[model samples]
Target chain A: MSIRNKYEEELTTVFNKLIAMCRTVEIAIEKSVNSLVHRDTELAGEVIKEDKNVDNLEHEIEQDCLKILLMEHPVASDFRDVSAALKMITDLERIADQAADISEITFQFGEESFIKEPFHIKEMAKLATGMVKDSVQSYINRDLELARSLDRRDDGVDNLFGKIKGELVELIKKDGRNADQAILFMMIAKYIERIADHAVNIGEWVEYAITGYHKIG
Target chain B: MKDKKQTVKDNLDIFDFTSDIAVNIKSLNLYYGNFQALKEVSMELKKNEITAMIGPSGCGKSTLLKTLNRMNDLVDGCRIEGSITIGEKDIYAKDIDLSALRKNVGMVFQKPNPFPMSVYDNVAFAPRTFGIRKKAELDEIVETSLKRASIWDELKDRLNKSALGLSGGQQQRLCIARSLAAQPKILLMDEPTSALDPISTGKIEELMSELVKDLTIVIVTHNMQQATRIADRTAFFYLGELVEFADTQTLFTCPADKRTENYITGRFG
Candidate 1:
């Protein structure tokens, strides 16, 4: 193959690696929460081990992004994509850290009764994880509509966080002994909400790749 | 060498050549006997702007330049059709005075064709042809025109020396000075610096950049770099038709059409 095709192929590989890493983290998040809610210590070990893969892929994609930027003086859309990809990975790696933070809480809550139903937590994970996937694909395809669609869904995640906060406050007031568990749950939901926000940041970057715009609320 | 591209008839409209413009052309065609050189060409030169005519040799860039001032009238079997105008004045009208129109719109050739006379007289010659006869007035016009052409300081003391004694660069400056002396609102330059060395070319470019603030200049050149550097806007002509007309930076950096990209990248000429 020609050198240009080879370079593009390598870039495609990097994009695939990032998308796969996002998927893995999404699954790990769901599995990590399941380990606590169902008292499945087996799933907790799996979540902890899965993080090594995220760390490895993150390192590999970061190195490749740097290589592309150094070698190519790409103009216009390609320039935006490479830059956005480099930045998106930083937030992705941090999301991985947040997922790990949620996983560590599983051991802390091992002995306690279920403080509340896990539906809201599960939904937050699903929404943010899907946003991460959609943003990466939108960027790779340069699909402005898809990027904008992902951008809008962040409002849903924010609303979910609000409902979680209100429910926790009422539960704590009803039983003062529930205070510690309620606050810990709120903190976990807060981290998940912030993960949704960082995913929105990635979606905005995708919009920039397609239309050279980064407008947001 | 002049850059040439195959002029696709359907694509020529991209340059948006118009005749209703202050400058008009209609069914304008040229030939060197049996060779129908420019095919049913119709276009215009907009008022008070630098219009660049670019194409390969024999595509009739020089033919069209000469046709403007009726310089092609000297060529054997060089037939012209249709009309060209400046505002309401149709230049091709029989009653239209060729000499007077040429006086109002002066020309500079590919080579620096300064007349073989004193530097001061070369500029003074065009005004004299139009009957400006006072010696004191002539001297004043000479100094002002030379200074405007940016060569007065270099040749101020050598005004009476033979034009041939000046270097090639100086001769081109003298040619520009001569054009300025005509006090023409429009100047047509046909590859005015292709013959000079690099320094001489640089001087002509500098002079052109300076002159355009006062007069509308139309230049025909093959050098893409020179066109990019000096023109506020550029029109790319190929095979007797215009391919693109855009801002200079747009034309050079990200040409809109495939043919423009090919030509600009030096894939073909």
Candidate 2:
């Protein structure tokens, strides 16, 4: 094979591995959030362990991309894609960390049943998962419009998070006994909100890959 | 727009050329979409010589080169205003045929695009397209073109093989040969060696020096070292403006413009 073909093959393998890592983390976040709301410690443990695997994948892809940058000295669209992949991995790794944080919280309250509805927390997870999936899809397809659209959706997540904080304050004021649990629940909501924000960062990187610009929307 | 800028240009006007010119641009302006790239740019290309266009990225050096061959016409919404005369005929004249103009002017891109064909086919395709026929004629043209590009010895045995099989430098040289096979009067190379290794770039620089004997060549390059090696004259551009034009030795050694000196001495782009 030609040198270009060899580099392209390596690029594809690394990119596919990155996308797989994102997908695995997305699933982990989904199940871990469910475990928190539904009081399933076992599923939370699985999500924590899966995040370790995601970390390894992130490191592997990071090295592959750095190797290409140092060796081939690519330009134009190919250069853009390689750099975007690096930035995307950074955000993806952060998303996995948020998922792991949820798992840790779930493990902490293993004995106590999840009393609160956590409806707002569940919505936050769903939005975050959507962001991760769309961000990676935009990167894969070089879809500038969809990638930029993540910013608008991010505003929605932020708004919902603010409302959740207000509701938790009301819950704490209503009953003194549930105050500690309400604060823990608020921390979980904060982590999920951050996951969504990191997803937006990935979206920004995808746009950068396609257009060589960093701004979203 | 400012009086101080006008005063600086008055000094630039002192530099003059009084001789035969292969290309004479009189107030050329180029536009893509709504943004103007070249603004009333005027310069002369001396005949049968290597003139290097040097500038930071997006300074309209490539735009000026493209206009010489009318490659700007390939871009949608790109409008060229004012006269660009090649060999004393208006290139923008309504009666001028684009294909014939392109036959006289050829281009090599920054990256080597060898048309996904066999090594022999890449050199022969253009001549054949322009109405050259017969096995003896094609073979002769390919041999001469490759020899001129300085890749004949390396590629002579693999003439039937795919161009994709060649090294990056060899493929790029083949691209130059393909352009030469058309027998163009002027060759426009846009950073040809910016894609190759140092060794490959050295070979190309040597080939360019040899080909200067017969053809008028205009090259755009970021490498200051490559320009000194092959170019006879150099033009410096900054922000879509032609800053200065002079002999290669003089430009590199004693540039009239501060910007040109800064760019060459590794202080700035």
Candidate 3:
């Protein structure tokens, strides 16, 4: 039997923790957007509180990577796994922070109706959440094709952000009275777009872990 | 930006034949009693550098090393086909002096096979074989060889003691000192550290790095980490064939051949 059996088990736990953190960030973004759509203040509060657990999971995975690096003297693919995990956790943490930021914006709107129903903004949130989930799935499964496809998939969220900005600008111009609500909706759209960008970054790290080359996209 | 780094790494792996080639073999084939030991093997050992040969057992790594100094000549029914040249002279030429060839190239074995004589005599034996009859010259050679091998300080006062009385690690170093006593231009070592502790292995590895400034070294080792640590170029042999040869870093991290990758990663069947 290989002596690396024990190290391999520890690595499996790190992989599971990364997936759990992905799911947490995915849930946070979903709940934050749902709260805004349904005017639920309690769900927004829950998302804001869940960010700490994501932070703790990131810390735990980082510690495991460092311990394996020091103890196992990993080479070849094992070396790539540890290094990719280190970079990946940073992007995962950023996604969690952006989710909390979206939840904060939802709290500001309170129970008031949005300037317009947030159909585009909610679509952007769903797309971004799917991206975060799929990117982590690509990493766990070592699916190079799925990771590469996320780069093109990121363009959808970016396009949605541009469309939201144009619509919000027109609403503000239609009446100076809609300026406060229009600007807040635009800020929420920007936060969801940022989450999609972080997911793209995670895909790039997954590619690096598999092939040792991170595409600039 | 990555293209430039990759180009530099590629250039380092290429062998520039315009410079000095210490040892060159062309289509070399060796067989012992109809069992092929080496098949059309050819490689160039760069001067003043350490080249490590690595593979599994009976992969012909040691057979290739032995051919560098014609040590396989003693084996019964061993027939070789092809030419090997050291410098400008063919080592297998009819008129070549065996003593001169052995003098120019020295070898260290797997085990520390120091003679049963005293430490001083062991170091002096190589020089005396070439007919240096003066006491002062022999004494100077003994001191300098021990110092160069990095064992002088430990054995300076114990020169009169038998080499067999030394520890396994110390005896290995003494064997290295004995090899250096001949002042050979090339050193061939077959698993020099396989029998020593890690600390002793580290010392020998350090000594090899220092020795490469003046001598060419070819080592056959089973330990892949040792090759990555000390060798500038690594040759991977498989089933009596020269499979891949490249700079040590490239060979380990991204070997060009799948067999080389499997062997180095311990996945070989």
All candidates: DockQ: 0.07, 0.01, 0.24
Model 2 DockQ, alpha carbons vs. true complex: 0.01
Report lDDT (CA) for all predictions: 0.76, 0.84, 0.87
Q: Name the lDDT value of residue A139 in candidate 1.
A: 74
Give the lowest summed-lDDT range of ten residues in model 3 chain A: A72-81
- Residue runs of model 2 more than 4 Å from their true location after superposition: A1-217, B1-19
Place model 1 in a CAPRI quality band.
incorrect
lDDT per residue as tens, model 3, A1-217:
3446777888899999998999898888999899888988889889889999999999999999999877765655666778888998999899888878877888788666778999999899989999899999998999999988888988999999999999999998999988988878988998888899888998998887787677774
Q: True contacts preserved, each candidate? A: 0.00, 0.00, 0.09
TM-score of chain A of each: 0.91, 0.94, 0.96
**Candidate 1 C-alpha lDDT tens digits along B1-269:** 01122122122212122332545667777878888777666766665667777766776777777877788788899887777776457777777776666766789988888788899899999777766667887899899999998899999999999998998888988998998887776789999888889988998888887777666678899987688778877766667666677777666655666566556544443
Q: Rank the candidates by DockQ, best first.
A: 3, 1, 2
Candidate 2, residues A3-56: lDDT per residue as tens digits?
Answer: 367767778887798779889879988988988987888888898888888899
Query: Which candidate number has the best DockQ?
Result: 3
Q: List the residue pairs that clash in candidate 2.
A: none
Tens-digit per-residue lDDT, B62-110, candidate 2: 9999999788888999998888888667888987767667767889999
Lowest lDDT 10-residue stretch of candidate 2 chain B: B9-18
